[model samples]
Target: MSTLLKPEAVNRPSMAAQAAESVVIVMAGADQLPVRRKGGAKPVSVDLLAALVEAALPDGFGGVSRIGFETAWEAMAPETRRALTDDLTCYLGWSASEKRQAFPADPEDLVRYLRWLEQGRGFRPATLTRRIASISRIHRMLSLSSRDTLPTRAAMVADALKAARRRRGSQQRQAAGVRLGPMMNPQDEVEGVTLAMLFSVCTSDLQGLRDGALLAVAFESGLRVSELAAIHIRDVDPQADGRGILTIGKTKTDQEGEGRYAWLSVDTMRRIGAWLEASGLEDGPLFRRVGVDRRQGRPARAPQDYFSIPGHTRHWQERLQGRPAEPPLARYAIGEGPLTRQGIGVIYKRLVRAVIDEGMVELEPGREGDLVRAISTHSMRVGLTQDLFASGEDGAGVCQAIGWRSVSTALRYVRKQSVKGGAVSRVMDGLRR
Candidate 1:
């Protein structure tokens, strides 16, 4: 597990500060449940814990949830907190390893780290900006000289951020559009890959059924991969009219868990049903990793991985290092657990590329190669958003359909698509008048 030794190598408090005493800050490891290191009159000081928390937490715009401090830390998902901790720890290690300065990196050295991350490490400008904020928080909690506050080098962090922007430009302003193309005709292989073409090739088999259902549902819902992976079978309720409602139990937008619903088409509902029937899953996660036993016949049921979530008893990463003989799953059995966020994207990419190789996607003359690399798990969501805009659906209405908390986000998608088709660009097209 990634850890930043408290400045001065101070030991961590045995327990966390009580609610009455102070705010809770989680310091969970990959292989264990979060041990509450409460602050009191103890060997480990509260100041050390504060440094660790400050190092791990996000303080920049839209970093933390908009919810109040009452349960905000608790509301911050363990996975998210863990990720921040890892990022912060990695940065500190780099600072020391490079001999830039001491553990609490000096301002002059931080500037070097920024440049190195961009040019040497190949981190984007946006990521560089976030890292600077994290570094700033570290200095605040550790009571060290801050790049932002030091009078001699005040605006040093700002200068780094400005340099980052100059290097790569604004990331949010770039959202590529996905346009529909000819659907796959089984006999005649389609060359250009379209969302419809890709979905059509995924048949009603074990893996195909799951991929088809997920693609269709994602297209209709426009959910992030995390939201899609979090979906449980119980959350889906089919309506008598063929359309179904999907209750997103949790999301980045609805951090409070005041669940929202997104409508799915009858087609998507049917695809989901097909997968469910084939998998023999009564309940639990709807999307799961496919069993890759590669055995001859259908095998016995594999045991459910109960201790496989946050504090996984047998964390995959650790297991890999030791090199176990047998594979994770002995036989082919669908999991009762949800798919990992990374798995969703991996599956989507694999399926799309599979169809592309099979000549199922018809493309324009030379764009086939570029198109394959471009389509992401989000292609379905982006395509749907673009389609909605082209079909004249208003921003507010689209937001409601897609379960977006704000119409502003939906507007960005619309605006992005609009710019591609903007009249101003067309006037200067070909020969100028």
Candidate 2:
């Protein structure tokens, strides 16, 4: 990405300083988007900024391949960015210590490093590929003139990749389903969890409303946990027929940034409406932090969701004139900050257990444990996809419904579900007659 040289704020000391004998080249484009404290009051020289931009280029990335643009990098999921960062850090440390140079542009050095990672550290081929991508990123930081001086060794690095399949075949651990059959709420109450029971025994407060709504929406929508956490108040579009539409602005699949929409079931919409009314939500992120304050005697502030409503912030400000806002005076309290993806998982597990506590269904001794193990932040998405496949939804229909970008992804989801009332399996059963 063309480094925006934002505020010339050096996030941290770069490897260049250590390798280049303390000649500091500010790493261009790190955390340029998020407004932060400026690096220093003194303005940076144009020459230094130019050097930083040059130093930041990956090895073979030329000006023509859109590698210089930051949009795609910025759009990556937080987890992906963090992994890349870690991989790069690991490579730089190893290369500096082993090769006597921190950043190596030569193809031979890159290959040796990969072998070291594989033979010495026992890093898997998949991990090696990720590290290679990171190496490319660091290479891009070097000056364009330096880029030409070095050979375009990226292809050779790719050729050097160890076969992942032979050494350590890896696959994502698929989440287990909460239920089967057409999407339905809990039926009976006897030590099993379901959406109905979870909602029924909710704390009867704002958090309860939100969690219940979140659970229902997650099950109905089949959203990835991160995508679900990213939902905004304005994304919900109500329809005349009681059903609603949900706009997913960004997802892993949407490379072009043109977002897609999903249908919101009538039942799901009702829970969401209840949550909106209870929280006084208006516009902004939908899910947020909700908990009991550690201190005593404090009602929660109005949710930021209500900030768009006229007089909403003013009304609250007027109520507590000079007083600092405290947690709810009552036992429970909620906050306006958004929940991270991890928090979403915690909430899901808590609600699932709550369902079990309410005796939602008669579970055999080990069945509850099975359900507990199966249910995760990803369970709803997996369960919904499986249910759709089990209910005779074709591959194309399933992908569209589940917001899957490819038929292959759709196929992977239902592999385990294939035997559970699957279309071809059901038809094949008739042969026994």
User: Which candidate has the highest TM-score of all?
Assistant: 1
TM-score of each: 0.65, 0.61
Q: Report the number of the highest-lDDT candidate.
A: 2
Every candidate's lDDT: 0.60, 0.61
Pick out the ten consecutive residues of candidate 2 with the lowest summed lDDT.
Answer: 1-10
> Tens digit of lDDT per residue, candidate 2, span 273-330?
7666655656677887654423343454544444454674556644444344553232
lDDT for each residue of candidate 1 in 100-125, tens digit (9 for 90 to 100): 44334566777777888889888888
User: Which sections of candidate 2 miss by over 4 Å?
Assistant: 1-80, 93-102, 105-129, 136-163, 179-201, 294-333, 353-376, 420-428, 431-433
Q: Residue 327 CA error for candidate 2 (Å)?
A: 16
Candidate 1: clashing residue pairs, number: 16
